[model samples]
Target: MKNKVTAALIASAMLGCLGTGVYAGSNLQEIKAYLNPGIKFKVDGQPVQLTNSSGAVITPIVYDNNTYLPVRSISNLLGVTVNFDGKSNTVELGEQTEGVSIAKGFDSSYHTKDPKVTIYNGKDYKDVFFDNGSGTRGSSFMLYPEGKYQKLYIQIAAIGEDLKEFTIQDSDTDTVLKKQDVRVEDGLVTIEADISGVKALYVHGDAKSGGSVFIPLTTSYYK
Candidate 1:
């Protein structure tokens, strides 16, 4: 019975598959370079500002050999519930399972072993090699090292404040959750998942400019 249940979950993949190599268990930095096809939002009849369509798509993202997009816009147009935690810098779209989570975030502070990582939001704030990565409203994903938590911080954010769009599975898993319409009050977001059975957490981004940021094989067992 347990095998059947697990099989159903794995086979259905309500959230879609991560990729060929994106294992449920791995130690390498989980950064998928797959260019996800996406749709643009439209209002009335033409491509307007708000998200009314879920068929138009944006091209692939060419970066580090990975394709990224804004996630915020995608969730909204798709009619999914979304949330962004600014304080903790994370995003949660849709519900995992009765309030469970398929969430992600970034912490530029994750990679302590590597000295070159000094950029925040893709910018150099302290003269170090940090990258500053933020989202406005689109589909994109990214992964960062959060040493404080001894885990990689995954993120799913929209691009530009420009109101972006994205694509997702439809139901059950992680892909087709929703837009980050709701905001986490404390900036501290949490997820209760079976991390033991799950080898890693995922960092997803939305489409805005550089697209969304993601970190595969990302960990999130905050203890």
Candidate 2:
């Protein structure tokens, strides 16, 4: 006989079987389930091997003509962090912020001026190179996060003794998101902006003293 079961009930039952002490309560009902080892999982056209936290392979559970997958395994495959809260009997996905380097997504195609990604103080940084001898102004570049990130973190520092000015603007609306001044004496100044729905960003930096300012490559966060 075919039996129907909610995904939440299945998860709660699984956790209880694993000694998590979380049960579905008086409403709990038993359902027939079949382990379908022949089922294959693919992500982005690539085959993915599903494994539990103990390194054991896990297969899909077939019930009532429907397929059920483990929350943890699926979350891991998508680069998302998953956590089980036994106290509240809750499963959380993407609760922690994940950071990706801005250098990887840096694009200069939409820039008004030239900004380059280079090493600064033994670390990778994206900044504008200015020549005081040639009387060159500051530089700007573009970053297309495509509304995939929730926050942008910029760590700015002066190259030498000069103070640096940095500005972040929304490319689509031309609205200023953040503006800050950084100096060598202050060390690294971190600027955080809410880019929850921002599609593109224009980053501008200026240093009148001909010194270059840079933002470390490791400061973009998404949830």
lDDT of each: 0.32, 0.60
Cα TM-score of candidate 1: 0.21
For residues 57-137, could you state the per-residue lDDT of candidate 2 as single tens digits? 987788877777666565445544445566566665443334766767565532113334455555544443323232345
> Model 1: residues >4 Å from true position, as ranges?
1-196, 210-222
- Which regions of candidate 2 deviate over 4 angstroms? 1-96, 109-136, 161-164, 219-223
C-alpha positional error of residue 3 in candidate 2 after TM-score superposition, expressed in Å: 42
Question: Count of backbone clashes for each model?
Answer: 72, 0
lDDT of 1 at 158: 25
lDDT of 2 at 65: 77
Worst 10 residues of 1 by lDDT: 144-153
State the lDDT at 35 in candidate 1: 54
TM-score of each: 0.21, 0.47
